[model samples]
Target: MRTLSRECGVTDADNPWLSRPVAPQPSAPAYTGAPTARPTGPSAPQRGVPAPDRAALLPTIDQRQDADLWWLGAHGGAGETSLAALIPGWPAAGHGWPRTPGAAPARVVVTARSSMSGLRAAQTSATQWAAGLVPHVQVLGLVLIADAPGRLPRPLREFAQVVAGGFARTWTLPWIEAWRLGEPPALTAAPREVRRLVDELSALLRPGADGTAN
Candidate 1:
């Protein structure tokens, strides 16, 4: 906002009515304030700005639901849709925390791929849940979808083991060629592991903390 200042001319001693032209005064020395604040350390976030790690996290679903369990995706291609198709009526919250109405805690099973990046995303989600970033949310476990046709590389498998400890239990899914070919998961026969997942998740979907399924 550029405000226009009307500077009334200084009154002249010689003439009372007519305005007088004043000589320009010397410029004042610049008043320097304290040395510029050092850029905040990595631990300290800037004012009104979110931390880098927090900012990097994907936005969570805003809609609230009171359901048995939510498939919380770790990334964009975390296979939320296909899994949802397999278990019809279950809601999916992509890369975001699932919300439940009132004081009800959201029941979540984090989903991601078995690849390096996918596992990393899953790690972030697990870390967030472990850190209690959102209170009253229960992270039941993790479900790692096969990233390719073969077994995961040794490094990824090891890293996955580390990430799995963040949650209670972890489930693995084999790669489905039919899903890749655009076939609906619900129509195709689910693998034994997938069926086990469905059954175990169904049993573990209880809203109580005590006496959960193994």
Candidate 2:
């Protein structure tokens, strides 16, 4: 009997269903794993390499005591010391916050000139105080010392307005020729504007009085 395979000339070797051996896949490369002995803390410098002084990276801030209020400079030359002397408050160097040992008042008056730059600094400080960024310090108000003896230029006046707008209370001091000449202006001889500032500050600092003054 003629078989179907013989009729079609099919062979066992030509059949696709025949089993075949597959080449083995290459072995995956082994991982040694990450180093387990990483040094802790700051990395050690190379031999003979001088280590940087970490302390010098930050500027030093001086803190002092005395007085019920602190006059902080919003920027350099903000007349903090002079205003402190005139206003019966502690003088804070630069913008450093006051640090008294015990029972010291946290009320702070940020001082700056009426110049554009000074006004900007005052605005930043007022915003920070309003946001409570300055720890343990209550911002009473802003004191803007006149940058010149005469009326502020229109631009500076506008800038001053922008800065004072952020604060609930603000005091502006007119330019004193004596102060510019390195002499303290006597309170009695002070201008009406200056006297008004003194009166308001005195009222605000009175015992059992809230920090705000009209």
Candidate 3:
């Protein structure tokens, strides 16, 4: 099984605000279980985003459920909606679209602190997305993910840092960075040095480690 290095786990150390978990390729069983369907039809494409074609990246729903957590980083980079569909169950009560009085609420702050307008926009987008899916909440872990790195305004990056601090797990999507440029970030097949960092970060995600358990 491939593993992430310690360094890969956290975000940019120099800028704590960008701290996030390095992506891990967990065992297939980790995300196996539950079966969720995807909404059909053409999804409007965002400019400057070079995501993987939706039809080419359908995830196995059952696998997503088996895992304790998943970080859907496909935002505008690949089949994000298709990947999210892999989680069979819907988001819990408060977290779902049209959030309930008190549900599995997650604050989508766009940094450590954001103005009222940004928060409102985040909530609005979240609600709209949630509305299209089913309603159930087994989300003990936060799906700490960002949307559209290409368009990531300054406020959102700060908000991402705040969310990163609060959650035990985080998934940084590679494509968003590509959006900032005009293409995807290059990946090295022999990324020995980089892989070591990933291992370290994965270690921190475990229970009883940094005391950041779910």
> Best-fitting candidate, measured by lDDT?
1
Residue 197, model 1: lDDT of: 73
**What is the alpha-carbon lDDT for the whole of candidate 3?**
0.29
Positional deviation of 95 in candidate 2, in angstroms? Answer: 2.9
Ranking by TM-score: 1, 2, 3
lDDT of 2: 0.56
The deviation in Å at residue 56 for candidate 1 is 3.1
Cα lDDT listed for each candidate: 0.60, 0.56, 0.29
lDDT per residue (tens digit) for residues 1-214 in model 1: 0000011122233111111022442221122231221111111111222112775465656565465667888888898878876654466776678766746666677899998889878866655554446555666678899999998889887777766654567788999888899987862387888766766665554334232322
Expressed as tens digits, the lDDT of each residue in 1-214 for candidate 3 is 0111122232233222222122454332222222221112112212222223334332323221223333332122322232223332221122212222334322121111133343333323322222223232121222332343354677665554454332333334322343345443222321332233234333433444332222
Worst 10 residues of 3 by lDDT: 1-10
Evaluate model 1: give its TM-score: 0.70
Candidate 3: list runs displaced more than 4 Å. 1-65, 73-201, 205-207
- lDDT of candidate 1 at residue 18, scale 0 to 100: 19
Which of candidates 1 and 2 is the stronger one according to lDDT? Answer: 1
Error of 2 at 99 (Å): 3.0
What are the root-mean-square deviations of the candidates from the true structure over C-alphas? 27.2, 33.8, 16.6
In candidate 3, how many Å is residue 144 off?
A: 7.8
